[model samples]
Target: MADSVGFIYTFFLTAAVIYVSAIVIIFGVKEQPIRSKEAKRVSYSRKDVLIHIFKQPLLVVTMLLTFITQVGNFSIQPLLALYIHDLHGPVNLAFYAGLAFSATGLGNLLFTRKWGDLGDRIGHDKVLLALLILSSILFIPQAMADSYVMLVIFRFLYGMALGGIIPCTTAYIRIKAPASMQGEVLGYNVSFRFLGNVVGPVIGGIVASHYGIPAVFYVTAGIFLFGALFLWAVRSHAKTNERSV
Candidate 1:
């Protein structure tokens, strides 16, 4: 029976991979004619573009905020299953764990594009600030949640708030960064994100061991609030400079 189960699992996994690969091969290949248009838009050399991006206050601060927010967002990831257990979850702990984990993605998927559009219409920085504050508020309930259902609900809302932040940051970058270096700056943002992923769990584990799981949520909420304030300062400084000029 065990051998049969293993064989079936492997067979389905292999079939899924092949199916996805085929779809990608069929539909994913495209030649971008926009490359020429992009090149024509920016006359600066790559080195100059790099230096300009590095010197931009908005880009630097946005990247830092990205790092901080990602760290806070993912800090509780490794503890979610254990948290469910603490809540005295239903018999299928694994199922609840999966549900709690996926709830964030579902919320993110639903809200990301809407937030992106809103950012485009209004202002990315403003939208990002609002989302950060909202996310921080949502984390409070998550930290205090006593039931599995409540935890899932909070996670879902947290995810929705988080889903808006990254795209807003990206939109801000595009508006402020030199067109030639936008891709590189975005890549750096992604690196910061991964750096946060690396550090979040380690720091979370230490905090959880010392204080408790709930404390992790509290800490993350504080971090998000701090990041929002930092972004606000940066935005304010920019406006002040613009007015003075």
Candidate 2:
């Protein structure tokens, strides 16, 4: 009976979200000019754009880091409900699970724009590196958590770290992409992100089932660390290139 109620509640909530999102997108599209110079100027040869992207090592690194971080971040979502149920029994797990998952989305809603503005004001790479390190550190508590409450706390902290990542990544790409090829670059970036989202949950579930819930956190941490290291390497290379120039 409780599970049935929870399912209905979740279904309605999901439908509400979809409805709101559709409305926002509809209104947003109506507000935009149907055609503009900026849109018209968004033309570039494929070979030339590819060559330009290859030349910009930092941008490539940023894209790779973004993909890795997103995969790690999203991988745990599908298994979170199961994890909560296993830790605390299934009685009210759905409510708690929704709260845990929604916490991250709420955090993102509140912080993403702020982080994007901050990234624009400061440096995207610097903000991204900090977020990666913070995310990695926060995953420690999550991996070791013995109770649902502890997991929730860790997940909230994780969400806070996650809140800043996407905006900063998008800002980094915008700053690094050639003005002429921005559209193509952004399109590719979006595709990669979607690819990460599709794969993360499956991988997370498999690893958690095989190894343990804690392994999920450890794996996420490792992926974030790798992204951070890669970004740091790119930063170093950028400095060297600037010095040479």
Candidate 3:
């Protein structure tokens, strides 16, 4: 009942925000005039978009990293209740698990915009590297935790570290993609994110049921580390390409 109420309230709130944003975009702000027919044309067909994306090596790396990170992040969320129950034998495991999942949203709400601003001030690669490393380190405590309190602490830390990843990834994409193809590129990125959402829980459930709850954290850490290494390699490749150019 409480969960249902919360979901309804959240839905209304999100709808209201979207409604306001649309209103603002439509009336509260000035709009730019449409481009004339004589303006340069950019191909946005599916095949052309895919070809454009494949041409940019950095975008491919960013998509892969985002996919892996998102999978690792979301995979553990659904299993947290079971893990918490096993760890602390709580009377209200569902409530505590909801709290655990809420921690990630809280972290994102508090830090996502701030991280984006920071990425703009610093560089996306630096911010991405820091967040990835910190998130990976936070997983250690989560994997080793034996109590609900400890699990909550580790989860919160993990959430805070992860708060920066999406913003940085988006910022990197913006810098890498041409203005004309931004939407197409972002569409591809969103597809990868959705793929992660689909795969994460299935993998998490399998690992948690067969092996153990801690396996979730260990697997998350491993995936995150793989993303970090891949990002580092991509950064190196970018520098090499720049030098060659």
Candidate 4:
């Protein structure tokens, strides 16, 4: 699309798609609040919402992971086309670049629900940990890809791993946070992710300019690795505390 009509038009087309999706959500997705038999009301203040999230180890850690995940994920965006051209040379670049980018979304589409099911059966923390580590490992291979095909393949796998993170994080919050506060807490989680989205490209641009495009992948991998380790330590400490109690 960008090749045929320019990126400005391509962006407009993308915006149209987003509008359609939003319309569908607005029209088709209805939420009727479940009423308890007693119908009692609990007033959860905004300040309490902030304090509650901080007190919950899982919520705080998952929010951090969400931020880290977005940072690592978007860090590749500014550099991907350049990397593709450097590795594959500059012929028919648009088609190859589109496929390389789309492959990750395709993987996410096919495997996210499966990962969610697996998380339901096992545990979201364990699932999130596995995905973080897998995502970390996947980024390194992209740095070392020998061909366009290899980069696309690794990205698809990385996308599949990435798919699990959101569901697992959302499920963790949903299961643990009170129903009255779930929406606000999730909103906070999203704010962290959006902040990461803003910061990610800047970091990628700076690192690629200074250290070259491949170095961005290494930095992305480190971010995911740090997230995995952080989640693991929190999960372990929580379990040990449970035992002591």
- Score every model by TM-score: 0.87, 0.87, 0.83, 0.93
lDDT of 1 at 184: 77
Top candidate (TM-score): 4
lDDT of 2 at 67: 80
Q: What does candidate 3's lDDT look like per residue over 62-149, in tens digits?
A: 8988889879887887887878788877676557777888777787788888888899999988899889888888887888987778
Predicted structure 3: lDDT: 0.82
Clashing pairs in 1: none
Q: Between the candidate structures 2 and 3, which one is better when assessed by lDDT?
A: 3
**Steric collisions counted per model:** 0, 0, 0, 0
Model 2 bad stretches (over 4 Å): 1-20, 34-42, 178-180
Show where candidate 1 strays beyond 4 Å. Answer: 1-27, 35-47
- lDDT, candidates in the order shown: 0.85, 0.81, 0.82, 0.91
In candidate 2, list every pair of residues with a backbone clash. none
| Per-residue accuracy of model 4 over 168-239 as CA lDDT, tens digit each | 999999887888778898999999999889889999999999998889999999999999999999988988
Whichever of 3 and 4 has more lDDT, that candidate is 4
